[model samples]
Target: MTQLKQIKLIAFDLDGTLVDSAPDLALAINAMLVDLGRSEFSEQTIRHWVGNGAEVLIKRALSGTSVIAEDLDEALYLKAKPLFNRHYSERLCVASKLYQGVGESLAALAELNIPMAIVTNKPGLFTQPLLEQLNLARYFDVVLSGDSLARKKPDPLPLQHLVEHYQLNIDQLLMVGDSKNDIQAAKAAGCASLGLTYGYNYGEDIALSGPEFVADSLETLVELMNGSVTA
Candidate 1:
């Protein structure tokens, strides 16, 4: 294991990392499919499609597969996007909840006076309402959604923007998330990252992403953040 270091601003990916929003997203996607007279997807299938954003989720759900092709019909995709958004807005948080120990970990971080932010591929509309419903909004000083900027995760724009706006040292920031995009963004932005094994990794092992640490649970992540784990 790499040596753990002191962290200042801890940025998180919202959907898979902090909140298990797959249920709600599945509900909405299946509803859209049913409306279109297409087959509905299973919750487990939807779970694998998440973390890439709603548009990607919608595409994956509608196609009945996770594989995306560039030659897909733009007209049909544009038509389906709004339907998914509408259904999702109504069903947001109906089944979503904070992952185990998430609330406690956030509170503990607050008590320690550590700054935090949400950096997720979820759109602002869904992210804000879901966090508000889960009562997790107050824990973050900043919430950078997928649509917040022109580029999303894997581009390093969000992390760069956060580091610049908050006047934080790049090395002092840590990215906690559950997918390749998160790890890539952290690496591109010159920050350390911790991956959650329990979160969505799109059927791939998170270890291949090369996060500095891989935590089995939020409690374990809190321990690492609190310096309980020896470097």
Candidate 2:
């Protein structure tokens, strides 16, 4: 087994790893689809479409349907974005819940005084509300969203900005996420990454993303971060 190193700052992806937000997102997307006179998608399909932010999600939800055009309709997507946001705000906590042990793990990390931030592809509007709903907002020192920066994950800009903003040593930072975008961003920004087995990976196995470690559960992640787990 690879030896785990001491970590100082921990960054997390919000949607899949921290919260099971698919249900609320699915509900919002389906509501838009219904308004457009289009059929709704299953929760599983919406799960795969998440992690790329709201516009991409709307694109995926409208895929293979007449309501969506071949050429990317900026106007249509923009119009739909606010509708999704409005619907989601009402349904945010109706179905979304933290994965088991997430709250406890976060509390443990907080006790350690480890600086934490959220680096997610989710837009700030929905991300803020959802985190507030789950009661996880106070745990994060910084919340970097897709709309917060000029570029999103897989581009490394977000992580790079975070490292510079925090004045952190790359080796002391750990990025915890559930997808290749997270892995790629962490790698490019020269931070260690831990992938969660349960998050969305867009059909690819997360192991193939070459993260430094794979966390089976949030509890296991807390143990590893606290140095309770030996190599």
RMSD to the hidden true structure, all candidates: 1.4, 2.2
Q: State which candidate has the highest TM-score.
A: 1
Among all windows of ten consecutive residues in candidate 1, which has the lowest summed lDDT?
A: 1-10
Local accuracy of candidate 2 as per-residue lDDT tens digits, 1-231: 343466778899988898988888889889988877888888887888888787788877777432345786677677777788788878878998898889999999899888899999988877888888789999999999999999999888888888889887778788999999999999998888999998688777888999988886778777786678877
Count of backbone clashes, every candidate in sequence: 0, 0
Candidate 2: C-alpha lDDT = 0.84
Output candidate 2 Cα RMSD: 2.2
lDDT of 1 by residue, 101-176 (tens): 9999999989978889999999988888888889998999899999999999988999999999888889988999
Rate residue 216 of model 1 by lDDT: 79
